[model samples]
Target: MDISKYIDYTLLSPTTTERNIIDLCHEAKKNKFYAVCVSSSYVALAKQLLEQTSIKVCSVIGFPLGSTATPSKVYEANQAISDGADEIDMVINLGFLKSKNYVSVLKDISDVKFAIGETPLKVIIEVSELNKNEIIKACEISLDAKVDYIKTSSGFSKGGATLTVVKIIKKTVKDSIKICASGGIDDIETVQKYIDIGVSRVCVSSDFNKKKQSI
Candidate 1:
Protein backbone atom coordinates (compact mmCIF):
# COMPACT_ATOMS: atom_id res chain seq x y z
CA MET A 1 0.00 0.00 0.00
CA ASP A 2 3.06 2.25 -0.29
CA ILE A 3 3.30 2.62 3.48
CA SER A 4 6.41 4.79 3.20
CA LYS A 5 4.11 7.67 2.35
CA TYR A 6 2.39 7.18 5.70
CA ILE A 7 5.56 7.22 7.76
CA ASP A 8 6.72 10.14 9.97
CA TYR A 9 10.36 8.87 9.98
CA THR A 10 11.20 9.91 13.56
CA LEU A 11 14.14 10.24 16.00
CA LEU A 12 13.26 11.78 19.38
CA SER A 13 15.62 10.39 21.97
CA PRO A 14 17.56 12.35 24.60
CA THR A 15 20.82 11.15 23.09
CA THR A 16 19.92 11.92 19.47
CA THR A 17 23.01 13.64 18.09
CA GLU A 18 23.28 16.24 15.33
CA ARG A 19 24.68 13.68 12.92
CA ASN A 20 21.73 11.41 13.70
CA ILE A 21 19.19 14.13 12.78
CA ILE A 22 21.07 14.85 9.54
CA ASP A 23 20.99 11.17 8.70
CA LEU A 24 17.29 11.01 9.59
CA CYS A 25 16.42 13.90 7.30
CA HIS A 26 18.38 12.29 4.51
CA GLU A 27 16.57 9.01 4.99
CA ALA A 28 13.14 10.63 5.05
CA LYS A 29 13.85 12.55 1.89
CA LYS A 30 15.30 9.50 0.19
CA ASN A 31 12.41 7.24 1.23
CA LYS A 32 9.83 9.89 0.36
CA PHE A 33 8.21 9.58 3.74
CA TYR A 34 5.47 12.00 4.73
CA ALA A 35 7.65 13.89 7.27
CA VAL A 36 10.63 13.78 9.61
CA CYS A 37 9.73 14.10 13.30
CA VAL A 38 12.44 15.36 15.62
CA SER A 39 12.89 17.18 18.89
CA SER A 40 12.25 20.94 18.62
CA SER A 41 15.93 21.61 19.36
CA TYR A 42 16.74 19.93 16.06
CA VAL A 43 13.99 21.63 14.09
CA ALA A 44 16.29 24.19 12.52
CA LEU A 45 18.82 21.61 11.41
CA ALA A 46 16.16 19.31 9.99
CA LYS A 47 14.55 22.25 8.25
CA GLN A 48 17.89 23.24 6.75
CA LEU A 49 18.53 19.68 5.64
CA LEU A 50 15.06 19.24 4.12
CA GLU A 51 14.63 22.75 2.74
CA GLN A 52 14.66 21.54 -0.83
CA THR A 53 12.18 18.73 -0.30
CA SER A 54 8.43 18.62 0.13
CA ILE A 55 8.78 16.46 3.22
CA LYS A 56 7.52 18.30 6.31
CA VAL A 57 9.51 18.67 9.51
CA CYS A 58 7.52 17.81 12.67
CA SER A 59 8.67 18.99 16.12
CA VAL A 60 7.54 17.79 19.53
CA ILE A 61 6.52 20.09 22.41
CA GLY A 62 6.28 19.08 26.09
CA PHE A 63 7.83 15.86 24.79
CA PRO A 64 7.82 12.57 26.69
CA LEU A 65 6.26 14.30 29.65
CA GLY A 66 3.24 16.59 29.52
CA SER A 67 3.85 17.99 33.01
CA THR A 68 5.47 21.19 31.79
CA ALA A 69 3.67 24.51 32.11
CA THR A 70 1.44 25.50 29.20
CA PRO A 71 3.53 28.57 28.50
CA SER A 72 6.62 26.42 28.11
CA LYS A 73 4.88 24.25 25.52
CA VAL A 74 3.57 27.31 23.71
CA TYR A 75 7.03 28.87 23.54
CA GLU A 76 8.60 25.63 22.37
CA ALA A 77 5.99 25.16 19.67
CA ASN A 78 6.32 28.74 18.55
CA GLN A 79 10.09 28.52 18.41
CA ALA A 80 9.88 25.29 16.44
CA ILE A 81 7.63 26.95 13.89
CA SER A 82 9.98 29.88 13.63
CA ASP A 83 12.75 27.34 13.12
CA GLY A 84 10.77 25.92 10.18
CA ALA A 85 8.75 23.08 11.62
CA ASP A 86 5.70 22.30 9.51
CA GLU A 87 3.80 20.55 12.28
CA ILE A 88 3.69 20.60 16.07
CA ASP A 89 3.20 17.37 18.03
CA MET A 90 2.62 18.57 21.57
CA VAL A 91 1.89 16.23 24.43
CA ILE A 92 -1.37 16.75 26.33
CA ASN A 93 -1.40 17.58 30.07
CA LEU A 94 -2.54 14.19 31.31
CA GLY A 95 -2.40 15.43 34.90
CA PHE A 96 -4.93 18.12 34.18
CA LEU A 97 -7.16 15.72 32.31
CA LYS A 98 -6.85 13.12 35.03
CA SER A 99 -7.76 15.62 37.69
CA LYS A 100 -10.88 16.50 35.65
CA ASN A 101 -9.28 19.88 35.14
CA TYR A 102 -10.66 19.74 31.64
CA VAL A 103 -10.63 23.51 31.43
CA SER A 104 -6.89 23.65 32.02
CA VAL A 105 -6.31 20.81 29.59
CA LEU A 106 -8.36 22.55 26.95
CA LYS A 107 -6.50 25.81 27.49
CA ASP A 108 -3.18 24.03 27.43
CA ILE A 109 -3.88 22.72 23.95
CA SER A 110 -5.72 25.79 22.70
CA ASP A 111 -2.94 28.11 23.79
CA VAL A 112 -0.40 26.10 21.88
CA LYS A 113 -2.67 25.92 18.87
CA PHE A 114 -3.03 29.68 19.00
CA ALA A 115 0.71 30.09 19.29
CA ILE A 116 1.39 27.93 16.23
CA GLY A 117 -1.29 29.71 14.14
CA GLU A 118 -2.55 27.15 11.60
CA THR A 119 0.62 25.10 11.53
CA PRO A 120 -1.20 21.84 12.15
CA LEU A 121 -1.19 21.03 15.87
CA LYS A 122 -1.13 17.31 16.68
CA VAL A 123 -2.07 16.82 20.35
CA ILE A 124 -0.41 13.74 21.77
CA ILE A 125 -3.14 12.23 23.97
CA GLU A 126 -0.84 9.48 25.29
CA VAL A 127 -3.61 6.93 25.18
CA SER A 128 -1.54 4.38 27.05
CA GLU A 129 -1.68 6.52 30.19
CA LEU A 130 -5.42 6.82 30.19
CA ASN A 131 -8.27 4.36 30.32
CA LYS A 132 -10.89 3.92 27.61
CA ASN A 133 -13.09 6.72 28.94
CA GLU A 134 -10.15 9.03 29.58
CA ILE A 135 -8.90 8.40 26.09
CA ILE A 136 -12.28 9.36 24.73
CA LYS A 137 -12.39 12.45 26.95
CA ALA A 138 -8.90 13.46 25.84
CA CYS A 139 -9.89 13.08 22.21
CA GLU A 140 -12.98 15.19 22.73
CA ILE A 141 -10.98 17.85 24.56
CA SER A 142 -8.47 17.87 21.72
CA LEU A 143 -11.27 18.37 19.25
CA ASP A 144 -12.47 21.30 21.35
CA ALA A 145 -8.94 22.72 21.37
CA LYS A 146 -9.28 22.63 17.61
CA VAL A 147 -6.15 20.61 17.10
CA ASP A 148 -5.56 19.21 13.64
CA TYR A 149 -4.57 15.79 14.90
CA ILE A 150 -4.92 13.62 18.02
CA LYS A 151 -1.84 11.43 18.35
CA THR A 152 -1.89 8.25 20.45
CA SER A 153 1.41 8.20 22.32
CA SER A 154 4.88 9.64 23.02
CA GLY A 155 6.73 6.31 22.65
CA PHE A 156 8.71 7.06 25.84
CA SER A 157 6.20 5.39 28.16
CA LYS A 158 5.67 1.89 29.37
CA GLY A 159 2.76 1.38 26.96
CA GLY A 160 2.55 2.14 23.29
CA ALA A 161 -0.07 2.34 20.58
CA THR A 162 -2.52 -0.48 20.26
CA LEU A 163 -5.13 -1.38 17.70
CA THR A 164 -7.76 -1.29 20.44
CA VAL A 165 -6.87 2.24 21.58
CA VAL A 166 -6.64 3.46 18.02
CA LYS A 167 -10.12 2.16 17.39
CA ILE A 168 -11.38 3.89 20.51
CA ILE A 169 -9.75 7.19 19.55
CA LYS A 170 -11.08 6.92 16.00
CA LYS A 171 -14.59 6.38 17.28
CA THR A 172 -14.30 9.52 19.42
CA VAL A 173 -12.58 11.94 17.08
CA LYS A 174 -14.35 10.61 13.99
CA ASP A 175 -13.60 13.02 11.14
CA SER A 176 -13.51 16.16 13.24
CA ILE A 177 -9.83 15.65 14.05
CA LYS A 178 -7.28 13.43 12.30
CA ILE A 179 -5.90 10.41 14.16
CA CYS A 180 -2.16 9.74 14.44
CA ALA A 181 -1.36 6.42 16.12
CA SER A 182 2.29 6.41 17.16
CA GLY A 183 4.54 4.41 19.49
CA GLY A 184 5.71 0.85 18.94
CA ILE A 185 4.78 1.14 15.29
CA ASP A 186 7.36 -0.33 12.89
CA ASP A 187 6.38 -3.02 10.43
CA ILE A 188 4.30 -2.63 7.30
CA GLU A 189 1.80 -5.14 8.64
CA THR A 190 1.32 -3.13 11.85
CA VAL A 191 1.15 0.15 9.99
CA GLN A 192 -1.34 -1.25 7.51
CA LYS A 193 -3.57 -2.23 10.40
CA TYR A 194 -3.73 1.43 11.50
CA ILE A 195 -4.41 2.68 7.96
CA ASP A 196 -7.19 0.15 7.51
CA ILE A 197 -8.78 1.42 10.70
CA GLY A 198 -8.77 5.02 9.35
CA VAL A 199 -5.73 6.44 11.10
CA SER A 200 -4.39 9.43 9.18
CA ARG A 201 -0.77 9.08 10.32
CA VAL A 202 1.59 6.81 12.24
CA CYS A 203 4.91 7.67 13.80
CA VAL A 204 7.18 4.88 12.40
CA SER A 205 9.86 5.48 15.03
CA SER A 206 12.25 2.83 16.39
CA ASP A 207 12.00 0.67 13.30
CA PHE A 208 12.80 3.60 11.06
CA ASN A 209 15.87 4.42 13.17
CA LYS A 210 16.83 0.78 12.94
CA LYS A 211 16.54 1.47 9.22
CA LYS A 212 14.46 -1.62 8.51
CA GLN A 213 14.80 -0.22 4.97
CA SER A 214 11.94 -2.28 3.59
CA ILE A 215 8.35 -2.84 4.67
Candidate 2:
Protein backbone atom coordinates (compact mmCIF):
# COMPACT_ATOMS: atom_id res chain seq x y z
CA MET A 1 0.00 0.00 0.00
CA ASP A 2 1.23 3.51 -0.80
CA ILE A 3 1.22 4.95 2.70
CA SER A 4 2.60 8.32 1.72
CA LYS A 5 -0.84 9.65 0.92
CA TYR A 6 -2.10 8.82 4.40
CA ILE A 7 0.80 10.49 6.21
CA ASP A 8 0.74 14.02 7.68
CA TYR A 9 4.45 14.88 7.75
CA THR A 10 4.95 16.71 11.06
CA LEU A 11 7.53 19.02 12.70
CA LEU A 12 6.09 20.53 15.90
CA SER A 13 9.15 20.74 18.16
CA PRO A 14 9.62 24.01 20.08
CA THR A 15 13.05 24.54 18.55
CA THR A 16 11.78 24.27 14.97
CA THR A 17 13.43 26.89 12.75
CA GLU A 18 12.60 28.40 9.34
CA ARG A 19 15.21 26.22 7.65
CA ASN A 20 13.63 23.16 9.26
CA ILE A 21 10.19 24.00 7.88
CA ILE A 22 11.62 24.53 4.41
CA ASP A 23 13.21 21.10 4.58
CA LEU A 24 9.93 19.61 5.86
CA CYS A 25 7.91 21.12 3.01
CA HIS A 26 10.45 19.87 0.52
CA GLU A 27 10.22 16.31 1.88
CA ALA A 28 6.42 16.38 1.86
CA LYS A 29 6.40 17.53 -1.76
CA LYS A 30 8.96 15.02 -2.94
CA ASN A 31 7.24 12.11 -1.21
CA LYS A 32 3.75 13.29 -2.11
CA PHE A 33 2.65 12.95 1.51
CA TYR A 34 -0.89 13.98 2.32
CA ALA A 35 0.08 17.10 4.32
CA VAL A 36 2.69 18.96 6.34
CA CYS A 37 1.78 19.48 10.01
CA VAL A 38 3.53 22.34 11.80
CA SER A 39 3.02 24.78 14.65
CA SER A 40 0.69 27.75 13.91
CA SER A 41 3.66 30.09 13.60
CA TYR A 42 4.98 28.34 10.48
CA VAL A 43 1.68 27.94 8.65
CA ALA A 44 2.30 30.76 6.23
CA LEU A 45 5.84 29.71 5.45
CA ALA A 46 4.78 26.10 4.87
CA LYS A 47 1.84 27.34 2.78
CA GLN A 48 4.15 29.43 0.64
CA LEU A 49 6.68 26.63 0.22
CA LEU A 50 4.04 24.04 -0.67
CA GLU A 51 2.21 26.43 -3.01
CA GLN A 52 0.46 24.81 -5.99
CA THR A 53 1.05 21.36 -4.52
CA SER A 54 -1.76 19.05 -3.48
CA ILE A 55 -0.16 18.71 -0.04
CA LYS A 56 -2.30 20.38 2.64
CA VAL A 57 -0.92 22.54 5.46
CA CYS A 58 -2.06 21.59 8.97
CA SER A 59 -1.42 23.64 12.16
CA VAL A 60 -1.66 22.57 15.76
CA ILE A 61 -3.56 24.72 18.31
CA GLY A 62 -3.24 24.45 22.10
CA PHE A 63 -0.42 22.11 21.08
CA PRO A 64 0.93 19.47 23.48
CA LEU A 65 -0.96 21.17 26.26
CA GLY A 66 -4.71 21.67 25.90
CA SER A 67 -5.14 23.86 28.97
CA THR A 68 -5.32 27.11 27.06
CA ALA A 69 -8.43 29.29 27.38
CA THR A 70 -11.20 28.55 24.85
CA PRO A 71 -11.06 31.99 23.24
CA SER A 72 -7.31 31.69 22.83
CA LYS A 73 -7.62 28.42 20.99
CA VAL A 74 -10.34 29.97 18.83
CA TYR A 75 -8.11 32.91 17.97
CA GLU A 76 -5.14 30.65 17.23
CA ALA A 77 -7.23 28.45 14.95
CA ASN A 78 -8.53 31.45 13.02
CA GLN A 79 -5.10 33.02 12.74
CA ALA A 80 -3.61 29.80 11.36
CA ILE A 81 -6.41 29.55 8.82
CA SER A 82 -5.91 33.15 7.79
CA ASP A 83 -2.21 32.41 7.55
CA GLY A 84 -3.04 29.60 5.06
CA ALA A 85 -3.46 26.45 7.16
CA ASP A 86 -5.64 23.88 5.41
CA GLU A 87 -6.56 22.01 8.58
CA ILE A 88 -6.55 22.58 12.37
CA ASP A 89 -5.54 20.09 15.08
CA MET A 90 -6.45 21.31 18.57
CA VAL A 91 -5.80 19.54 21.86
CA ILE A 92 -8.75 18.83 24.15
CA ASN A 93 -8.71 20.07 27.75
CA LEU A 94 -7.54 17.02 29.70
CA GLY A 95 -8.06 18.78 33.03
CA PHE A 96 -11.73 19.41 32.35
CA LEU A 97 -12.25 15.90 31.12
CA LYS A 98 -10.61 14.46 34.23
CA SER A 99 -12.77 16.70 36.38
CA LYS A 100 -15.86 15.38 34.56
CA ASN A 101 -16.67 18.88 33.37
CA TYR A 102 -18.13 17.59 30.13
CA VAL A 103 -19.88 20.87 29.41
CA SER A 104 -16.65 22.83 29.42
CA VAL A 105 -14.89 20.17 27.37
CA LEU A 106 -17.64 20.10 24.80
CA LYS A 107 -17.82 23.87 24.69
CA ASP A 108 -14.08 24.18 24.23
CA ILE A 109 -14.07 21.93 21.21
CA SER A 110 -17.37 23.21 19.83
CA ASP A 111 -16.22 26.80 20.06
CA VAL A 112 -13.09 26.06 18.06
CA LYS A 113 -15.07 24.10 15.48
CA PHE A 114 -17.56 26.94 15.21
CA ALA A 115 -14.75 29.44 14.82
CA ILE A 116 -13.05 27.47 12.05
CA GLY A 117 -16.30 26.84 10.12
CA GLU A 118 -15.67 24.07 7.54
CA THR A 119 -11.95 23.72 7.98
CA PRO A 120 -11.28 20.23 9.30
CA LEU A 121 -10.68 20.24 13.10
CA LYS A 122 -8.94 17.26 14.73
CA VAL A 123 -9.23 17.10 18.54
CA ILE A 124 -6.18 15.59 20.20
CA ILE A 125 -7.18 13.69 23.35
CA GLU A 126 -3.60 12.92 24.39
CA VAL A 127 -4.42 9.30 25.14
CA SER A 128 -1.48 8.73 27.45
CA GLU A 129 -2.85 11.11 30.05
CA LEU A 130 -6.22 9.41 30.44
CA ASN A 131 -7.48 6.03 31.57
CA LYS A 132 -9.83 3.81 29.52
CA ASN A 133 -13.03 5.50 30.71
CA GLU A 134 -11.56 8.93 30.30
CA ILE A 135 -10.53 8.12 26.75
CA ILE A 136 -14.06 6.98 25.88
CA LYS A 137 -15.62 10.04 27.44
CA ALA A 138 -13.21 12.26 25.57
CA CYS A 139 -14.15 10.58 22.29
CA GLU A 140 -17.85 11.02 23.04
CA ILE A 141 -17.33 14.69 23.80
CA SER A 142 -15.40 15.16 20.57
CA LEU A 143 -18.31 13.64 18.68
CA ASP A 144 -20.72 15.92 20.46
CA ALA A 145 -18.58 18.86 19.41
CA LYS A 146 -18.74 17.56 15.81
CA VAL A 147 -15.02 17.55 15.26
CA ASP A 148 -13.64 16.22 12.00
CA TYR A 149 -11.14 13.85 13.68
CA ILE A 150 -10.01 12.50 17.09
CA LYS A 151 -6.24 12.36 17.17
CA THR A 152 -4.40 10.01 19.55
CA SER A 153 -1.47 12.02 20.94
CA SER A 154 0.42 15.32 21.03
CA GLY A 155 3.81 13.50 20.77
CA PHE A 156 5.22 15.33 23.79
CA SER A 157 3.59 13.23 26.45
CA LYS A 158 4.90 10.22 28.35
CA GLY A 159 3.71 7.92 25.57
CA GLY A 160 2.50 8.14 22.00
CA ALA A 161 -0.16 6.26 20.05
CA THR A 162 -0.79 2.67 21.04
CA LEU A 163 -2.86 0.03 19.24
CA THR A 164 -4.92 -0.69 22.35
CA VAL A 165 -5.79 2.99 22.78
CA VAL A 166 -6.58 3.35 19.10
CA LYS A 167 -8.89 0.36 19.30
CA ILE A 168 -10.74 1.91 22.21
CA ILE A 169 -11.09 5.17 20.33
CA LYS A 170 -12.28 3.33 17.21
CA LYS A 171 -14.93 1.36 19.10
CA THR A 172 -16.20 4.51 20.79
CA VAL A 173 -16.23 6.77 17.74
CA LYS A 174 -17.19 4.04 15.23
CA ASP A 175 -17.56 5.83 11.89
CA SER A 176 -18.74 9.11 13.35
CA ILE A 177 -15.30 10.73 13.16
CA LYS A 178 -11.89 10.11 11.56
CA ILE A 179 -8.77 9.21 13.59
CA CYS A 180 -5.22 10.54 13.32
CA ALA A 181 -2.50 8.61 15.24
CA SER A 182 0.50 10.71 16.15
CA GLY A 183 3.68 10.42 18.31
CA GLY A 184 6.36 7.70 18.11
CA ILE A 185 4.93 6.43 14.81
CA ASP A 186 8.32 5.93 13.16
CA ASP A 187 7.94 2.93 10.88
CA ILE A 188 5.89 1.97 7.83
CA GLU A 189 4.80 -1.35 9.35
CA THR A 190 3.38 0.43 12.39
CA VAL A 191 1.68 2.98 10.13
CA GLN A 192 0.05 0.13 8.20
CA LYS A 193 -1.18 -1.42 11.46
CA TYR A 194 -3.18 1.75 12.32
CA ILE A 195 -4.54 1.87 8.78
CA ASP A 196 -5.63 -1.77 9.01
CA ILE A 197 -7.63 -0.87 12.10
CA GLY A 198 -9.47 2.00 10.29
CA VAL A 199 -7.29 4.96 11.24
CA SER A 200 -7.71 7.60 8.50
CA ARG A 201 -4.44 9.45 9.00
CA VAL A 202 -1.06 9.18 10.77
CA CYS A 203 1.18 12.07 11.86
CA VAL A 204 4.85 11.13 11.40
CA SER A 205 7.95 13.12 12.20
CA SER A 206 11.04 13.90 10.02
CA ASP A 207 12.57 10.49 10.71
CA PHE A 208 9.84 8.92 8.60
CA ASN A 209 10.54 11.51 5.94
CA LYS A 210 14.16 10.33 5.69
CA LYS A 211 13.00 6.69 5.80
CA LYS A 212 10.45 7.02 3.00
CA GLN A 213 12.83 5.25 0.62
CA SER A 214 11.97 1.99 2.37
CA ILE A 215 8.30 2.41 1.51
Candidate 3:
Protein backbone atom coordinates (compact mmCIF):
# COMPACT_ATOMS: atom_id res chain seq x y z
CA MET A 1 0.00 0.00 0.00
CA ASP A 2 3.07 2.28 0.12
CA ILE A 3 2.11 3.06 3.73
CA SER A 4 5.21 5.18 4.27
CA LYS A 5 3.64 8.33 2.82
CA TYR A 6 0.54 7.91 4.99
CA ILE A 7 2.51 7.82 8.24
CA ASP A 8 3.35 10.70 10.59
CA TYR A 9 6.47 9.53 12.45
CA THR A 10 5.70 11.01 15.88
CA LEU A 11 8.06 11.87 18.77
CA LEU A 12 5.78 13.98 20.92
CA SER A 13 7.07 13.33 24.44
CA PRO A 14 7.80 16.22 26.84
CA THR A 15 11.31 14.87 27.40
CA THR A 16 12.09 14.59 23.68
CA THR A 17 15.57 16.01 23.04
CA GLU A 18 17.20 17.82 20.13
CA ARG A 19 19.38 14.80 19.41
CA ASN A 20 16.25 12.64 19.38
CA ILE A 21 14.55 14.97 16.91
CA ILE A 22 17.63 15.03 14.69
CA ASP A 23 17.77 11.27 14.60
CA LEU A 24 14.01 11.05 14.10
CA CYS A 25 14.22 13.42 11.15
CA HIS A 26 17.11 11.45 9.74
CA GLU A 27 15.07 8.24 9.93
CA ALA A 28 12.09 10.01 8.38
CA LYS A 29 14.28 11.29 5.56
CA LYS A 30 15.53 7.78 4.88
CA ASN A 31 12.13 6.13 5.19
CA LYS A 32 10.31 8.83 3.23
CA PHE A 33 7.52 8.94 5.79
CA TYR A 34 4.91 11.57 5.09
CA ALA A 35 5.93 13.80 8.05
CA VAL A 36 7.74 14.08 11.35
CA CYS A 37 5.42 15.09 14.19
CA VAL A 38 6.94 16.79 17.21
CA SER A 39 6.11 19.18 19.99
CA SER A 40 5.91 22.82 18.91
CA SER A 41 9.12 23.63 20.79
CA TYR A 42 11.10 21.58 18.24
CA VAL A 43 9.47 22.78 15.04
CA ALA A 44 12.38 25.04 14.12
CA LEU A 45 14.89 22.23 14.59
CA ALA A 46 12.85 19.80 12.54
CA LYS A 47 12.28 22.36 9.80
CA GLN A 48 16.01 22.98 9.65
CA LEU A 49 16.90 19.29 9.52
CA LEU A 50 14.27 18.57 6.87
CA GLU A 51 14.84 21.73 4.82
CA GLN A 52 15.69 20.08 1.51
CA THR A 53 13.38 17.10 1.72
CA SER A 54 9.75 16.54 0.84
CA ILE A 55 9.20 15.20 4.37
CA LYS A 56 6.97 17.63 6.30
CA VAL A 57 7.43 19.03 9.79
CA CYS A 58 4.22 18.71 11.85
CA SER A 59 3.88 20.35 15.27
CA VAL A 60 1.36 19.62 17.98
CA ILE A 61 -0.57 22.39 19.75
CA GLY A 62 -2.16 21.90 23.21
CA PHE A 63 -0.84 18.35 22.89
CA PRO A 64 -2.13 15.26 24.72
CA LEU A 65 -4.51 17.35 26.72
CA GLY A 66 -6.95 19.71 25.06
CA SER A 67 -7.90 21.71 28.16
CA THR A 68 -5.86 24.74 27.13
CA ALA A 69 -7.80 27.91 26.42
CA THR A 70 -8.66 28.83 22.84
CA PRO A 71 -6.32 31.81 22.82
CA SER A 72 -3.43 29.69 24.08
CA LYS A 73 -3.89 27.07 21.35
CA VAL A 74 -4.13 29.78 18.72
CA TYR A 75 -0.96 31.43 19.98
CA GLU A 76 0.89 28.14 19.83
CA ALA A 77 -0.39 27.49 16.34
CA ASN A 78 0.75 30.91 15.15
CA GLN A 79 4.17 30.40 16.69
CA ALA A 80 4.53 27.00 15.03
CA ILE A 81 3.67 28.44 11.63
CA SER A 82 6.16 31.26 12.14
CA ASP A 83 8.72 28.62 12.99
CA GLY A 84 8.01 26.89 9.65
CA ALA A 85 5.71 24.04 10.66
CA ASP A 86 4.09 22.49 7.59
CA GLU A 87 1.18 20.99 9.54
CA ILE A 88 -0.57 21.65 12.85
CA ASP A 89 -2.21 18.98 15.06
CA MET A 90 -4.27 20.57 17.81
CA VAL A 91 -6.20 18.82 20.57
CA ILE A 92 -9.88 19.58 20.68
CA ASN A 93 -11.57 20.79 23.86
CA LEU A 94 -12.87 17.45 25.07
CA GLY A 95 -14.07 19.10 28.25
CA PHE A 96 -16.22 21.51 26.30
CA LEU A 97 -17.51 18.76 24.04
CA LYS A 98 -18.46 16.60 27.03
CA SER A 99 -20.14 19.54 28.70
CA LYS A 100 -22.26 19.88 25.53
CA ASN A 101 -20.71 23.28 24.99
CA TYR A 102 -20.12 22.77 21.29
CA VAL A 103 -19.69 26.49 20.63
CA SER A 104 -16.41 26.75 22.53
CA VAL A 105 -15.16 23.54 20.97
CA LEU A 106 -15.83 24.85 17.50
CA LYS A 107 -14.24 28.22 18.32
CA ASP A 108 -11.13 26.59 19.73
CA ILE A 109 -10.46 24.65 16.53
CA SER A 110 -11.61 27.44 14.22
CA ASP A 111 -9.38 30.08 15.84
CA VAL A 112 -6.32 27.90 15.54
CA LYS A 113 -7.13 27.07 11.93
CA PHE A 114 -7.48 30.80 11.26
CA ALA A 115 -4.15 31.59 12.92
CA ILE A 116 -2.35 28.89 10.97
CA GLY A 117 -4.10 29.89 7.75
CA GLU A 118 -3.69 27.39 4.88
CA THR A 119 -1.39 25.17 6.92
CA PRO A 120 -3.13 21.79 7.24
CA LEU A 121 -4.81 21.47 10.64
CA LYS A 122 -5.32 18.00 12.11
CA VAL A 123 -7.79 18.30 14.98
CA ILE A 124 -7.36 15.54 17.57
CA ILE A 125 -10.74 14.64 19.07
CA GLU A 126 -9.32 12.24 21.68
CA VAL A 127 -11.84 9.53 20.88
CA SER A 128 -11.12 7.65 24.09
CA GLU A 129 -12.77 10.44 26.07
CA LEU A 130 -16.10 10.39 24.32
CA ASN A 131 -18.96 7.98 23.99
CA LYS A 132 -20.48 7.17 20.59
CA ASN A 133 -22.63 10.31 20.32
CA GLU A 134 -19.90 12.75 21.27
CA ILE A 135 -17.53 11.23 18.76
CA ILE A 136 -20.03 11.78 15.98
CA LYS A 137 -20.74 15.35 17.04
CA ALA A 138 -17.03 16.07 17.35
CA CYS A 139 -16.60 14.93 13.76
CA GLU A 140 -19.42 17.27 12.74
CA ILE A 141 -17.81 20.20 14.57
CA SER A 142 -14.47 19.42 12.91
CA LEU A 143 -16.11 19.35 9.50
CA ASP A 144 -17.52 22.79 10.27
CA ALA A 145 -14.11 24.02 11.41
CA LYS A 146 -12.97 22.99 7.94
CA VAL A 147 -9.69 21.63 9.18
CA ASP A 148 -7.80 19.26 6.92
CA TYR A 149 -8.01 16.18 9.19
CA ILE A 150 -9.95 14.66 12.09
CA LYS A 151 -7.51 12.64 14.19
CA THR A 152 -8.77 9.95 16.59
CA SER A 153 -6.46 10.05 19.60
CA SER A 154 -3.65 11.85 21.44
CA GLY A 155 -1.88 8.55 22.26
CA PHE A 156 -1.97 9.42 25.98
CA SER A 157 -5.52 8.39 26.61
CA LYS A 158 -6.73 5.27 28.40
CA GLY A 159 -7.22 3.80 24.94
CA GLY A 160 -6.05 4.94 21.55
CA ALA A 161 -7.56 4.67 18.11
CA THR A 162 -9.99 1.83 17.57
CA LEU A 163 -11.41 0.57 14.32
CA THR A 164 -14.89 1.21 15.70
CA VAL A 165 -14.05 4.86 16.36
CA VAL A 166 -12.37 5.12 12.97
CA LYS A 167 -15.45 3.71 11.29
CA ILE A 168 -17.69 6.16 13.09
CA ILE A 169 -15.39 9.07 12.29
CA LYS A 170 -15.09 7.94 8.69
CA LYS A 171 -18.81 7.52 8.24
CA THR A 172 -19.39 10.89 9.82
CA VAL A 173 -16.72 12.99 8.14
CA LYS A 174 -17.41 11.12 4.89
CA ASP A 175 -15.37 12.84 2.19
CA SER A 176 -15.35 16.15 4.05
CA ILE A 177 -12.40 16.01 6.43
CA LYS A 178 -9.61 13.45 6.21
CA ILE A 179 -9.44 10.87 9.03
CA CYS A 180 -6.19 10.32 10.98
CA ALA A 181 -6.13 7.09 12.99
CA SER A 182 -3.53 7.22 15.74
CA GLY A 183 -3.06 5.87 19.27
CA GLY A 184 -2.71 2.06 19.43
CA ILE A 185 -1.85 1.67 15.77
CA ASP A 186 1.32 -0.43 15.42
CA ASP A 187 1.80 -2.48 12.25
CA ILE A 188 1.20 -3.00 8.57
CA GLU A 189 -2.08 -4.88 9.12
CA THR A 190 -3.68 -2.23 11.34
CA VAL A 191 -2.30 0.52 9.13
CA GLN A 192 -3.78 -1.12 6.07
CA LYS A 193 -7.10 -1.64 7.85
CA TYR A 194 -7.45 2.04 8.71
CA ILE A 195 -6.45 3.11 5.24
CA ASP A 196 -8.89 0.71 3.66
CA ILE A 197 -11.65 2.20 5.75
CA GLY A 198 -10.97 5.75 4.48
CA VAL A 199 -8.49 7.10 7.06
CA SER A 200 -6.26 9.62 5.35
CA ARG A 201 -3.25 9.36 7.68
CA VAL A 202 -1.64 7.23 10.39
CA CYS A 203 0.22 8.70 13.39
CA VAL A 204 2.87 6.04 14.01
CA SER A 205 4.82 6.17 17.29
CA SER A 206 6.29 3.55 19.65
CA ASP A 207 5.34 0.58 17.48
CA PHE A 208 6.96 1.98 14.36
CA ASN A 209 10.07 3.13 16.22
CA LYS A 210 10.68 -0.30 17.75
CA LYS A 211 10.69 -2.22 14.50
CA LYS A 212 14.03 -3.50 13.14
CA GLN A 213 13.77 -2.07 9.60
CA SER A 214 12.10 -4.34 7.04
CA ILE A 215 13.70 -2.94 3.91
Q: Identify the leading candidate in terms of TM-score.
A: 2
Model 1 ranges off by over 4 Å? 209-215
Q: Write the per-residue lDDT of candidate 2 for residues 53-91, one digit (tens) a residue.
A: 999999999987999999999999999999999999999
Off by over 4 Å in 2: none
Worst 10 residues of 1 by lDDT: 206-215
TM-score of each: 0.96, 0.98, 0.97
Best-matching candidate per lDDT? 2
* Whole-structure CA lDDT of model 3: 0.89
Scanning candidate 3 in windows of ten residues, the lowest lDDT window is 206-215
| Per-residue lDDT of candidate 3, residues 12-93 (tens digit) | 8778889999999998888889999999989999999998899999999998799998899989899999998999999998
Model 3 ranges off by over 4 Å: 212-215
**Residue lDDT tens for model 1, 74-156:** 88998899999999999988999999999999999999998888799999988878998899899888888889998888999
TM-score, model 3 to reference: 0.97
What is the Cα-based TM-score of model 1?
A: 0.96
Q: What lDDT score is found at residue 140 in candidate 2?
A: 92
Give RMSD (Å) of candidate 1 vs. truth: 1.3
